[model samples]
Structure formats: structure tokens, C-alpha cells
Target: MFVSLGNLQTLYLHNNDISSIETGTFSHTPRLQRLELYGNNLTSIPQGVFDGLNQLQYLSLYSNHMKTIPPNTFINLQQLLYLYLHDNEISSIPTAAFANLPRLQQLCLSSNQITHIQSGEFSNLPQLRELQLQSNQLTSIPTVQYQFPELIHLNLHNNNITDIPANAFSNQPKLSTLHLYSNRISTVSLTAFTGLANLNTLYLYNNQLTDLPDYLFFGLSSLSNLRLQDNDILQIFPNTFTGISSLTYLLLNGNSLKTFPSEELSKISSIAVLYLQNNQMATLSFTAYDMMLSDVSTVDISNNPWQCDCQMVSFRLKMTGSNSFENQITCTDPRHNRRLLKNINPEDLTCEEPMIVRFEKGDDNSVEEGETLHMVCEASGIPTPDITVILPSGLHETVESGGRVIVEVNGTVTITDVTAADAGLYICIAASPVGSAFKTLSVDVQSKEPATVTSAVINITGKPESTLGSAPIFSLPVLLGSVIGAVAGTVLIGCLILMIWCKRKAKNPPPVPDTSVVFNNTNTTATVTTSGHDQTGQGWSHNVTNPGYAQRPAAPQPTLDLYEDVEPPPNRPTSKGAGPKQPAKKKALKPPKRNKAPHDERPSPPPPRTGAAAGAAAVYANEPAAALDNLPYYQPLTKN
Candidate 1:
């Protein structure tokens, strides 16, 4: 019961209870360019369903019960360009199901239950320009290498895709608009858009992406609108949006971003509308707003988890009543969590007090007498404070005077050429609109020399020498003169003893000689002369020749007892070579007398004895003894 119309170019079979697309159902229509088979109960598209339709250009198969598309289902439709298979129960497509359809351009497979796509499934469709596969059960897209140079738009929303392969859209050079929203995508590879040269619009909202790679939008030069809201994006690279110079609108609300990517996002000059609500942003840094100053016109930054601490006080003041953030901006946390900033006036927002200011000085306090007192004042505050100084001499001035003052915003001061007049209490005053504080400074000037006493000379000459030992002669003049005086007194006592002996000799009388003699004279006459000078020269030359000298008689030799009969024992041992007989008795040895005081006193105190003195004494004691023994001895005077 099949109609055989081999010349048919179009077919319409919509709203029918068709259970399946039978094999060879389009066998007679070899040149059919359009087919309509929507609203049917078809469960599957059988193998070889369009085996002979080689020039089919349009097909509609929507609202069907087809669960799968068999291989070679559209093998003969090589020229087909538009295919609509939306609202179907299809879960999968067989490999090579449309292998020969090289001219397929617009394909809409939306509202299906498809879960997977095999590689090379669309390898033959090199002319595909528009692809819509939204509302499916796909977890990922195949990494196909086909170059669809005419592809301008791709819609893959409402899917379960969790990941995107690197460079998945590289070969699509003409892809300008991409719709990938309402998916379960948590991550995107940077290379996912490697070759998308003409891509301009991107839709990535309602996903689960927590972080974006640095170069995720690198090659998309024509990108203008980027939608990435309703995700868990906690952090973004500082240069994430650098490549998209044409980007104008950016949506980033409903994310967990505590900070904004000011470095990367600010480079885009065309950005006008920015959406940044429902996140955890506490406060906006000045650097963040400074980056987006080119053409930003509107921004939505509400519903954030902001903390209204003291650090935010300055920011609150800056944002309130300011033209920079008057109508388009609002705070999204703290007391004004959901309140419109336009409704709340700037004067109504109050700022909290800042932390206390802490000041620090240098470590060393020893300032030079005439040098500058270099004092540094380091303090920390929310809004920097103004510092003033009061000098010790009651001179008040700012820290800029070169005489003894200099100040800085970093809390440092230097005082120059500080003198004794500059020593005393100094006060440093740090003030702000909220409150003021003061600190005391003390300075001391020290003197430079050691203390001692001066005294006159005190003579202790006649006093006994100290038992412990005399002090050094060079110690002081008074002590040295005392030692010299004691030594001179002992010399005077010895000179007096010699004078007393001479006086006693002058008072004594002379003794008389004996004149009785017996006969038996031997012609040896004993001559006696009263005068010391005898002109006859008979009494042993009694004339005294030397000046002031007395003449003395020669000593007598001992007489020998030759006549007495004595033993000649010693004469038997005499040798022929002996020159002369020795004297029988040696003269009695005299004991050395103690040195007198005047002669023994040295001209100067002997040099303190050291190792050099001991060496000199040893040399003198080692000399020959004969030289010392031959020295003449002094003889004593005797009375006759």
C-alpha cells in the first residue's frame, strides 16, 4: 500500500500515528528537497530510512517518540541543509547516521534526551553553519576535528555537561555567538576556544564554575557580551578578560567572589554594564574602580557578604554623595544589605572610628651636642594624622623648620643643630578630626672631662725611711725630696767623727825614749835626730822631699839564729830550680771596712735593677783574680 512517486520533491506527513520510519520509506522520492513528519508516534528511524533521497534540502521531524536514529538513516541526503528534530524522545544518534550529508547547515535537535555524542558523528557536515542541541541529556561534547568554517551560532543550553575539552571550538572559525547556559559545567579549559576567531557573544550563566583559567577567552577577538552569572566562581585570574577587547557587557552575579579582577577587567574600554551581585565581596578597593574608568556606565553589585569594619570607613565616605558612584552603584552587605543606595542619602551613612595611632622613635638617644636631633615619628591610622611638635625652650613649630625640625606623612621627624638650649621636655601632638593625642620627649646634654685635685710640695726630709719601701722618686716632688734629705743626714754624722779624732790628738803629750846601753859595740851606731830634716844625711835620709809628708824609718828584718843548734830538716828538700826561699809567716789579712756615708752616696739613684744588672755583675766577677789580688793596701800611721 505504498505510493510510488519517483518525481516527488516535497513530502508532508505531520500529526500521524507513525510508529517508525520504515526502511526505504523515501525510496521513490530520490529528488525530494523538503519533508515534514512532525507530531507522530514514531519510536525510531529505521536503517536506510532515506536511502534514495539524494537531494533533500529541508526536513522536519519534531514531536516524535523516536528513541534513536539508526546508522545510514540519512545516507543519501547529501545536499540537505536544514534539519528540525526538536521535541523528540531521542536519546542517542548512531555513528555515521548522517555520514553523507555534507551540505547540512542548520540543524536543530533541541528538547531531546540525547546523552552522548560520538567522535566523527558530524565529520561529513563541513557546511554546518547553525547548530542547536539544547535541552538534552549530554554530559559532554565530542572533540570533533571537522572544520565547519561557516558556523556562526551554536546553542547547547539546558544540558548536563560538566567539562569542556581543550580546543573543542578551534576549527569553527566563523562561530560568533555561543549559548552554553543552564548546564552543570564546573570547569572550562583555556584551550576550549583556541581558534574561534569571529566569536563575539558568550552565554555561560547558570553553571557551576568556581574558577576560570587565565586564557579562557584568548582567541575570541570579537567577543562583546559575556554572561557568566549564577555560578560558584570564587576566584578569577587577573588577566582573564584581556583578549576580548570588544567586550561591553559582563554578568558575574550570584557568585562567591570575595574580590574582583580589576587588572584584567579594567582593560576593556567598551564595558558599560557590569553585574556583580549575590557574592561575598566585603569592600571595593580603589584600585578596582580605577581600572574600570574608561566607559563604565552601569554596575549592579548587590547581595554580597560585606563587613562594615573600620577598614571600610574611608571607603564608605568616598562612595557616599560622590558622582563616581551616585546612581548606578550600591552596597550589598552589612546594614545596607539589600537597600538601594539611591534611597539612602550619603549623609545618613556613618563611618566607624579607626584604630589607635602608634608612634615609634629611633633606638639611640645620644644626640651630638651641636648636631641635629633626628627624631622619627611612626604612626598608623585609618586616615593619616597631622603631627606638631613643641620644643624644650618653649618654641613651638611644625616639623619643617631646618633649625631643629622636619616632618613627613609617614610619621617621621628630624630636629637639626640641637644645642643645650634645646635640651628639656618636648611634646609631640598628633591630631585628627575625631581626637588628638600627645607624647613627651626628654633630652639631656652631658659634660666631657674627668675630675681631680692639685696640691703644693710638702718636705719630710729628716724623717726615717718608710719600712715598706720608698715611693717612686718620679711620683711627686714632695716625696722625692724627703727621701734625699734622710740620706744626706747620715753622711753628715760620719764626717763629724773624723773631726773629733784630730782634736784629741792635739791635746795628748809625747812619750820619752830609753838611753842606758852596755859595752860590746859592733860599729853599728844608732843615730837619733830631733828635726825631720838632717843636713848630714846620716839617719837614713830624714829630709822629707814630698810636700807636707813625714819621713819614717825602714822596717827592720828579722834576725836569724844560725849559731843555735837546730835541725836542718827543711834544707834537704830544696830543689836546684827554685828561685828563692819563701817567707816563714804570712802577714795577717785585714777585714774590709764598711763604706762611709759621703763616698757611698750615689750622684743619682741607681737604675732600678733588672735582668741587665745581673748580667753585668756576672761579667765583672769572672775576671782574673791575680789582677785584683796585686792591688796595694793602705797602711796605718804609728807613734815612735
Candidate 2:
């Protein structure tokens, strides 16, 4: 096949039907500097096929049927500078397939079925400057990790990549151009291109991007072109273009943007070309119109559903004399359908007066103190009107007043922690350029009642008890103990009173009986000793004339002392004279038989005789029994 062509410097075997080759096909071409085997039907590459081609600097096996790359296929091609294996059926690259190619500068593996690439597959090629991997089946970009520090170009467009992760291209600091368009990229990390400081052109168009985050290009100072068109981007943040100061072209066409990035684009004074066509925008703001006329040179904002209402009058007036928007801007409103914005008369863009539809005049409302009050003041008009709520303090506030009252953009007022000072007439004014309307709400903030002091005073022991704000409650155990204590104190007071009354009755003694008795001196008036007389002083008498009385012996009487001054009886015989009157003999007194007394008819005790009458009765009771016996047989007279 090339057995003797050792000085071959360039060989073109492309566009042929060469499918099979021997292992030593390139062994004889040791000085070959270029080889092209593209547009062939080669299905496989044998190991060590280019073993002796040490000076091979260029190789092309593109548009072939090779499905895999052998690890040692290009082992001896150390001087390879260009490799093109695109438009093939190759699905993967071996780890060491291109390991020895130190001088490889450009590699084109685009338009292949390669779903992934092994890490460090192209690490040994320090001089690699361009890598084309577009129109492949790769789902995501590989993490190069500075493997190709000297590389300057990377093309990965039209792949199945779903998302661009953070620092996806950080290793490629010198990369000036990145082609990531026409992929399935729905989300891109905020720092996806953080280290691509020198990036000049970025193509992110024709993807599923919904929105661009703030500071997404914070460090891309050198970026000139940013193609974000043909995506589902809804809005571009205000700071999305903060660091791309040199950005000159911005393509945001064919997206779902209802509003333009006027604030973001106007800040970048270097933007030259602006594409906002085929979007859902109804009208552009004044800032966007001004930016288009002064800062941007080329502006294409056609094919949008423009609403030519009162709000679009300013934009239409600004576009009156400009021919750049001759047919690009048309109205979709029924009043001016398909009419060019520059052709419409400014006077026709009139609006109705703003009318407060939600709140009525003199709407009475009340709120308790320390409560929240929400009042809705909705209005309707051609253009949205600003709301202002005049507070009771005569202060006019639009959004918020101090910290207690807040007004939302949708015309709702929130008064939190309302106090008595917040009560009064609140006038809500909805004003716009066309006309103004208002609604009044009389708010009555009921003040809270003052705290009261309640007290309970109990005088249990004739002393003041406890005072409290409210009646105190006692537990069952405490209440039982208090009741028991009260009962014990009452019982102690009764017992002390009884003991004092009993001690006052023991101060008097009983009277003593008389110690002496007397008798009569005459025999006719003989006295009997009767110390046993009844309480009435009646003496007992025995009649000896009766037969029954003579049979019984007479009872002896108790002796009593006779008075020495009395004379003796004349009938008595004179006996030996007693030296002194002998004391009368005593006898034992018998206990008196008392008649049985009724239970309730006890006889009253006789009052003790304490005067001289008691002494006379005692004097007649000591007479001897012989003298009293003769007198009693003869009936003696009773004493009065």
C-alpha cells in the first residue's frame, strides 16, 4: 500500500471506498507530515496502525464508519498537530487514545455520536488550541480541570447538553469563543462562565433557558456578543449584564418576555445592537424607547403583540419621525389592529378616568386596639394609577407610613396594631395622568378599657384581712384547714366562761347549832330535856294514864346544860348537895324515821333560826326525865 514512499510529506486518501487497511500501511511512510483518510467506509482502526509515522503532524479520519478509537491507534504519531475525526459513528474516545500527541493543536470531533469523553483524553496535548465537539450526542461538557491550559477555542453546540453547571469552562481561561447554542440547556449556573474572562463571543441561543440570573456574566468584561435568542426566557434580571460592560450585541428575540430589560440594557452604555422581535411584549417603557434612540444603533423589536393604548402614546410619539420602526412596530389592539405605531395619531390614545371600584364613599369600619385592619381600595382604568392613603395625622403616604401602616401595590392598605390615634377619616386617592378618583373610609379604633383594681376585705377577727385585685381562690385543702381552725377557737371560748362561774359560789359556810338547853324550876312547870325536837320546836309527850304507854319504858333524852341562877324544885327531897350541878347524862340519839316524800313535792327546809328565840327553846330541853314524866301524865301547857 505504501511500502517504499518513505519521503512522503503529504498524502490524501480521502473520498474513496477504502474500508480495510493493513497494520503496516503507514509503516513505510516515516516522514509523512499529513494524511487524509476521510470520506471512506473504514469501520475500524487496528492498533499500532500509525506506529512508524513519527513525523505525522496532521491526520483526518472524518466521515468514516469507525465506531471506536483504539487506545494505542496513534501511539507513534507524537508529532501530530491536527486531528479530524468528525462526521463519524464513533461513540466514545479511549483514555489514552491521544495521550502521546504532544504537538496536537487542533482536534475536530464534531458531528459524531460521541456521547462522552474520558477525562485526560486530550491532556497530553499541551499545544492544543482548538477543539470542535459540536453536533454530537454529548449530554454535558467534561470537567477539564485545566487539562488544556493552552487551548483557546471550544465548540460544543447542537448537543444534548441539558444544563451548564458552575465553572463549566473555568479551566479554559484563554477561551475566547464558546458555542453552546442549539442544545437542550434549560438552566445555566450563575458561575458557568466565571473563569472565561477573555471570552469574546458567547452563543447561548436556541435553548430552553427561561431566565437570565443577576450577575450571570459578572466577570465577562471582554464579552462583545451574547446570543440568548430563541429561548423560553421570561425576564432578564436588572443585573444580568452588570459585568459585560463591553457587550455590544444582545439578541433576545423569540422568547416569552412580556417586558423588556430596559433597566438592564440602558445601564450598559456600550450596547450597539438590540434584537427584541417575536416576543410577547405589549409596550415598551420610556427608558427602553430612549435607549433605542440614543445608545443602540440597530434595534429590531417587531412581531410583538403591541397594545396601542394610552400607555403606548409616549412610545408612539417618540417613534413618529423615526423610519427605523416603519413596519417593525404594529399594533394588535382592536381599535388599531395592524396599524403602524408611527402612523397612529397621539390624540387617539385617550383613557377613561380612574374609578375606585372596590371601596365605597363613607365606608364605615371599626377595629379594636392592638388589632390589624385591612382595607382594599381597588381601581380600574386604561393605565394603572398610583394609590395614596391620607392618614389621620394629615400625612400623605403612598407605600408605607412609619411601621404600623403599609400599602401594597394592588391598592390594599394594612394597618397593623392599630391604636386610638389611627382612628379617623382615611382617604384613598387613585390618581393617574388622565383623571383621579377617591374613596373615604371612616375608621373607628375602639380604645381598650383600663385595668381595674378589685379588693376583698374580710373581718374575721375584727381586724382587716387581705386586699387583692380580684377575689383569691383557695384550694380544697386550704379551705378545709381554715374552717377547722375557726371551729376550734369558738369551742375554747365557751369552756373558759363555764369555769369562771363555778368558783364564785364557794365563799359562804353553813350555820352551827346552839350548844345549851334550859329547864323550868317549879314542879308544876317541869321541863323535859328534848334536844330531839322537830324543826318547829315541838316537844314529844307520852301519856302514862293510857294502858299502852305504861307498858313501854321511857326513852332517854339528850343532856343539856342547866342555868346555875335557877332555884331547885320544892317537891324534890333534899339529897346530899352536888358540889356543882352535874352535867346531865347523854343518850344516843336515834335517827328520825322520815316519811317518804313525793318526787316534786319536797318539803321546804326551815330557815335556820339565828336569833335569841333559838336560845329559849334550848333552855327548856334539859329537864330530868322523872320530873317530865309526872308532868306529861298530867297534861302540860304548850308554849306559845
Candidate 3:
């Protein structure tokens, strides 16, 4: 079908509509070194079609309608170094279809419909360096089990690979660049790139990665450029880039990072260009800005929800003096939406509103009267807010160092010797140019109970200088002791008075009983007589003073008439001098006095009527010394 052309080194047949090629048509070109058959309508290659082209070094069958390749199709083309079969309808390749091509260096099967490749199909290609299988229906990485020692580049992007298993590229030690972007890759094993010591560039963007595993790039020390943008990456592991020290370019934009990746970037200090735009970051800290701007030469952090508050003061200051940023770092806040970040002044970077951090004590507090009270109000704002404390007495204190109520500069309020008047709501106002924040505290001051003798002593003796304008504090025990002592003393005095009265009454006995006379007959007359101070016919007499010396008035001598059951003559009256003479009275006998019992043997006086009085008596009796000790000694006040 063709004449012999042994010296032809190249042939151009691309961009033609050739649908079929006759058998033995390329048999005449024995020494052909290059053949361009791309942009053709070829469907299937016949068996042993290239058996005569042993000297062919380059072949182009790309952009064709080829579906499958015959067995040993390029077996005779042992010297072939470049084979372009990409952009074809090839679904599957037969076993050993490309096995004998020992000198092949570049193989392109990209944009094909190949699903899976059988093992050992391309194992014999010892000189192969680059393989392109992108835009295929491949579910997993091919040629992973086989070693491509000399292969330098591999493109598996835009595939159906959901996960990169451990050591997926371990066989490709000499690989410098890998293309795994635009895949369904959600997770990459930590050791996936273990043997990729020579890897320089990696593209894994536009994937479903949520996070990068720690130490995932441990052995990739030579990696310089890593693109992981346009991913669902929420966070980067702390040690994910541990050994990637040579990294210079990093693209982490278009992610779900809520915070700046400072720790991860700290590991890659050599980064020169960084892209962190289109993230979920609301505000950046000063530390984050310093870390980002210190070493990176070019950084793109735009399109983030930047909060232009006090937190962005440092960032604004740094941007104000620099001219390196070209893109507009727009703010998303309502106050400065769509405004460039560099245009905002540092002094104008006030917070949306003043924030009250907290109160040292709770909002509702309690304190005892005459006690020191302290409360702290912590607040934060952009313009260094001025703190003022409003007292319950409607007094406003901005800065106080020494007084009954003091509000310190650090938002601390101290009130010495708190009284009932100090109990109420205290308001802490933190005002700034932007806004103000208020914190209210309610304090209940419990009034002290009435004091006793001991309480008075303690109050007089307590430190007076510390609580100058406030009430003096009293102790509970002192108050209680004073009350008890006063009660006991009253009861003791009453008992003593009663005892003295009783003793005086017992010492003097009533005058001797009065003598009475009775007459049974009408003719008899009788006169009464008594001893001791004029008893007057009465039985009992009380001479509280000197009863023994007093004598009763001598009554007339008693006369007795003994008339039994007989009426005497009515007119028979005895004359005053002629009356019957009274018999001489017998001498009165004096009673002997009984000796008093010893004090120890005497019974205790009936325990002073039981109850509060009895208890007080018992206490005073049992602990007389203690009661005496607690008694207050009065001293006359001097005009000192």
C-alpha cells in the first residue's frame, strides 16, 4: 500500500477525518521516528498494526475516536518514548497492550473513559516518566502497586477517588509534581506521601477534604507549593505540615476556617505567598496579623467577614503604613461594609458596644453593718472606657482613693464600715465613645442587734481610724455576755433585799398575847391585862424597832366571878374600892434562844422562783467570778 521510506523521520496526519486505516499501511515506514495521527476518526487499532515501526520514537493518537487498543499493538515499537493517546473514547486497555514499550517516557491517556487498569499492564515500561490519566472515570489510583522509579509527574485530577490510602504514592519516589485536585477526595492517609521525598508541588484543591491528618506530609520535605483551596476543610491539624519546611506558596482560601491558621503557618516559616481569602474568619487577632505579616511576602486575606472593632486596631495600623496589599481588604460589618480595611483609622476602631466582663462578686450581695465591703467591676471597650460607680445614696464616684466609699481606677469599689444606709443597688457604668455598659449590684446590709456592756467595751476599744465615719463593730459573744450580766445583777439585788427584810422580821417577836376576862353572872365585873407595849387585847404585834424595851400599858387587874347557873342580883354592883381584890399575877418567864445552824449545813434558800429569774440566779451563784468579770465598770467622763 506504500513505498518504502527508510529515511523518513517524521509524518504528519493529524486533524484529518480519516476513519479507517488499511492493514500493512504503515509497514512501508520502517524507520519513521515520529507519527502524528491525532484529531482523527479512528475507532479500534488492528492487532500488530505497528509491528514494523521499530524506529518510531513519538506517536500521537490523541483527540481520536479510538475505543480500545489491540493486544501487542505497540510491541514492535520498542524505541518509542512519547505516546499520546489522550482525549479518546478508550474504555479499557487489554492486558500487556503497552507492556513492551521499554523506552516510553511520556504517556497520555487523559480525557478517556477508562474505569480500571489491570495490574502489571504497564510494569515493563522501565523508562516511563510522565503519565496523564486525568478526566477519566477512574475510581482509584492506578499503578500504585507497581513502582514507577523514574516517573517524575502523575496527573490523576478530576477523578472519582474518594480517599487516598496509605502509601498511595510510595512507589513514585522520584515524582516531583502530583495532580489530585478536583476529585471526591475526603481523606488522605497520613502516610499517603511517605516516600515522596522529591515531591515539589501538590494540587489537591476543589475536593471534599474536611481536615488534613497530622504528619500527612512528613516525608515531603522538598514540597514547595501546596494548593488545598476550594475545599470543605474546617481545620488543619497542628502537625499536618511538620516536614514541609520548604513550602513557599500555600493556597488555603475558599475553606471553612473559622480562625486563622497561625499554628500551622508557624511551622512553614518559609512561606512567601499565602492565600487565606474567602474564609469564615470574623475577626483576626493582633498575634495572628503579626504572625502572617512577619515572614510572608504576599498575602491575600480578603473576602472574609472582618469585624472592624477594637480587635482590628493592630491590623489597621499595620496596613496603614504598608503599600504591599493591592486587593481591597473589604469589611463585612454593617458600619464599614465594603470599606477597605486600610482606610479605617486605629483610633476610630471602637467596639460595637462596651462589654462588662463580669463582677467580682455576684449581682446580688450581702454585707454586715460596720463591716468593710468590696466589689469589682470588670469591663472592656475600645477607647479605654471610664468607669464610674453610683452609690445607693445617689452619689457618683469616678476615681476615689480615700473615703467612706471608693471607686478605684481598675473598676474596684470599696466601702469601709458598711451601714444600713449603704444597702441598696450600686450601678457600675463603663462608658466609651462608642457606647456604654451598665452593671448593677444589690447589697443588703444587715443591721447589728442592740449591744450590751461587753459590746460597748469592744466598740470603744476597736480600731477607730479604719472606720472613721462609720459605726463601730460589735462582737456577738460580748453582746450576749453583757445582756446576761445585767439580768443577773438585777435578780441578785432583789433577792438580797428580800433576805434582809425577812431576817429583820424574824428577829422581833410580836408582843405577848393579851389576857382576856369573861363574866358569867350579871353581878361580876372583869378587867383585861397584858404585857409588852400596849397589845390592846390583840394577839400578834410587830415592833420592827427595839421591841424588847417597850411595855404594854398596864391594864386594870382582871376580876373573876364564879357564879354557876344562878342569876345574881341585878343591883348588886361592886364598888370601885370594895371590889374583890385581884390575885397577884405570876412572874413572866423568858424563853431561851436556840443556837443557829452552821452555814455549810444550812439548806439553800428555795432556789429563787424557777424560770428566767431562777436561771439567772443559778448562773450568778454558780459562776460568780465570771459574772463579776463581765460587769462594766463606770468611770466619770472628764473634759480631756
What C-alpha lDDT values do all the predictions have? Answer: 0.64, 0.74, 0.73
lDDT string, candidate 2, 1-640, tens digits: 7877879899999999998787888778889998999999999998878888888888999999999888867877888889999898988887888777878899999988988887767767788889999999989878763467877888999999999888898877799988999999998898888888899999999999998889999999999999999999988898988988999999999998887778878669899888999998877667777878888889898999886778887777767564585468788866788888777888987677889988632344888899888888898765566789898988787863457778886888887888888889989899976789998878888876544433565555654563334566666566677899889988888777776665543443231232222322322333233333333334343222223211232433464232211233335332322223323333333323345355566445322222222212222233453543333111133233
Best candidate, TM-score-wise? 2
Ranking by lDDT: 2, 3, 1
Poorest 10 consecutive residues by lDDT, candidate 1: 610-619
Candidate 1: where are CA atoms >4 Å away?
A: 1-10, 20-31, 48-52, 145-147, 285-294, 305-640
lDDT of model 2, residue 344: 84
Candidate 1: pairs in clash: 167-191, 372-417, 377-411, 399-406, 404-416
Worst 10 residues of 2 by lDDT: 611-620
lDDT of 3: 0.73
lDDT of 3 at 465: 48
Please, what is the TM-score per model? 0.50, 0.56, 0.54
**Which pairs, if any, clash in model 2?**
517-618, 518-619, 518-620, 529-621
Q: Residues 1-640, candidate 3, lDDT per residue (tens digit)?
A: 5586767789999999999887788888898899999998998887777778989999999999998987788888889999999999999988888978989999999999999888866778878899998999888875454578899999999889888888788888899999999999997877788888999999999999998878888978899999999998888889988988999999999998878888877898899999988997766666676776678888888777766777777667666445454244677766777887777777876675677887655444887888888899888765456688888999888863367878776787888988888988888899865789998888899877656422222334476644333445557787678899999999999999999989977886564432221212233221222112232321221212212332333343354221111222223222222223233233322222224355456433312211111111112223334443442221112232
